[model samples]
Target: QFCVNYKNGGISYRSARDGFGFELDWTEFYTTTRKPSAGEVGALPVSGGVINGNLGIGTPNILGGSSIVLGDNDTGLKQNGDGLLDIYANGVQVFRFQNDTLESKKSINVTGRLTPTDYGNFDSRYVQDIRLGSLQYGQVWNGPGFSDTSGYVITGIINGNSDELIDGAHRRPIQKLIGNQWYNVVSI
Candidate 1:
């Protein structure tokens, strides 16, 4: 049986087979898969703006805590275009993933920290690039497992006195640091 119920300010289908009809919204139309639960996907946001750019997709039902994450299990993070794919927080690009093999980019770029007065720009000094199969890193560039980070260009503050700088070959070492007492990072 076909049915139409004028409720919830706007009109919606109800009862017997609200006849599995189509819904018109804005410039698009959607067909119902089944009767929606009272609070299926939660209420729509009270307010928001239209998006006109790229975005990242994360694992379903997962909200980032201290750190935001993108991509998902059994998935491929792909962007097909002639532009850089970037992840930004607060209008600043914290990470950039790219497939450009040109001499300009060299490899992917990751921005961990920015200089105090250098917000909203890629300082390069504080950024880290993944650099897959880079020619400069030589054998370690996408080696059997992983190779030295020295080959790929990166910048970091190395404690000249306390902390040891293992491969100082490729890093643009900034020796301006306080007395040692530090944390460690594990990379693959």
Candidate 2:
């Protein structure tokens, strides 16, 4: 069982298992409004598995600075400010999405490819020995306790020469993923 009481008003509570329950006394229901002053104490009870103190003011998205920053700094995710979702595959950026409204039901889908031509070091290689392919998205490909998605593979090899390098050519599916709707999954 759980209960909440307002000094000037009444009390309310709810039990576990059945559903939700609440009650208010006349004084508590339509009680006189008594706003809290600067140092006044206001108490509200929240119940779940454990009970904790009330959430104080300035208790929103708060964070410090970072050592590195990826994507556009003007619109990158902020720690103390806002946050954006960034996705990467094999040390490469894939997509990024921002959560501006703080909505409960929100999701972003990213689709892109990594190619050898994209990297700077591969240009010197006399012989291109790298190949880039689509990474299959299996049901369990992402997150824990999931299976692998086939069709995704990275290919390339370095020649014997000290300067020889491997290049994996990749092609971004521009037609399929060209729009503001497609999130920028770049990360630091």
Top model by lDDT, which number?
Answer: 1
What is the C-alpha local distance difference test score of candidate 1?
0.36
Q: TM-score of every model?
A: 0.16, 0.14
Model 2, residue 131: what's the lDDT?
A: 34
C-alpha RMSD (angstroms) for model 2? 26.0
Error of 2 at 100 (Å): 25
| After superposition, candidate 1 runs with Cα above 4 Å error | 1-83, 101-188
Q: Superpose all Cα atoms of candidate 1 onto the true structure and report the RMSD in Å to 1 decimal.
A: 24.6
Measured over all alpha carbons after superposition, the RMSD of each candidate to the real structure, in angstroms, is 24.6, 26.0
lDDT of 1 by residue, 1-188 (tens): 22343352233432332235744332211236343443454533447533343333564412222223355422322233456454444333444566743223234456886336534354433534332232222222223323454323353332334545332223422222112322223344
Indicate the residue-level lDDT of 94 in model 2: 44
